[model samples]
Target: MSLRLAPSSKPSTAGSASVFDTSNSYGLHDTMRFGMRQIASEVTAKHPLENRLAEWENTQDELKMNLARNMYGMHAPIKMAMERSLVIKARGPSMLPRSSNLGLDILVGKDETIDFEDFLNVPELSTDMVDVHTVMEHQLGIRV
Candidate 1:
């Protein structure tokens, strides 16, 4: 997940070093050694980065669930006002962008097309914009 440059070395005191010499076996060996250490520490070792990523993922899921719950609650009053109404459904956030989906039920007889841009302008909802895009693609049946 990262690229690191090899540490620079001091120029040789003798005439052994050349400006055009691109082949530095010692430098290559040192770079490989550094790479091995990096891999051992980051990939093989028990690092906290993975744990932090998991925690962040859980928090995102919780936020998405909260948003969905609030949206469902908001729909309750409108549901009671009329027998049926336009419903906008958004799924909770997921690890994969394509996993999140939205279901919008247009049951009202309205002449104008209601844009959801205004309603979904909230920061919490916009955080998972990829989810929205996925849902819209699913609804519209447009293959990416």
Candidate 2:
């Protein structure tokens, strides 16, 4: 190996890392003669450049994720959870007089409707005045 000195724009001082008067004790060498392409190549990387290595690792992770997604798709429970989240998100005005959340209705698992009590904060119904048709349908699973 030959001793090589790399010139710097900054002046070296006793406090600084570089030494101006002698061959650097550190194994620093000029690699410009080897060409940038030679150093950039992965097959014979002169030194493992950290920035390039990190970029390559990120690209590899992305490729693996895409491949897995394309082959097996999202897991069933995760897909369901995502769909549920989307359903709960606020939607713009659809059919008016329609309450999307249903306030108390949605919590009770009612779909596509707003109950009498839910329409503009009507007072809660008394226990003695339940709808006979809804009660029968709920209990017997058949509409009168």
Best by lDDT: 2
Please give the lDDT score at residue 103 for candidate 1: 27
Candidate models: Cα lDDT each = 0.42, 0.42
Clash counts for all predictions? 0, 0
Ten-residue segment with the worst summed lDDT in candidate 1?
1-10
* Candidate 2 C-alpha lDDT tens digits along 1-144: 111122222332332222222223564432342322222232432333544453553444345445545667857435544555665675632322333444433432365656565555533433334555676576677854
Tens-digit per-residue lDDT, 1-144, candidate 1: 112122113322232322223234654424332322233332344445554554553444345445545668756544533433223344444433342233222333232455564366755445454566787678789999
Measured with C-alpha atoms, the lDDT of residue 135 in candidate 1 is: 71
> Against the true structure, whose TM-score is highest?
2
Least accurate stretch of 10 residues (summed lDDT) in model 2?
1-10
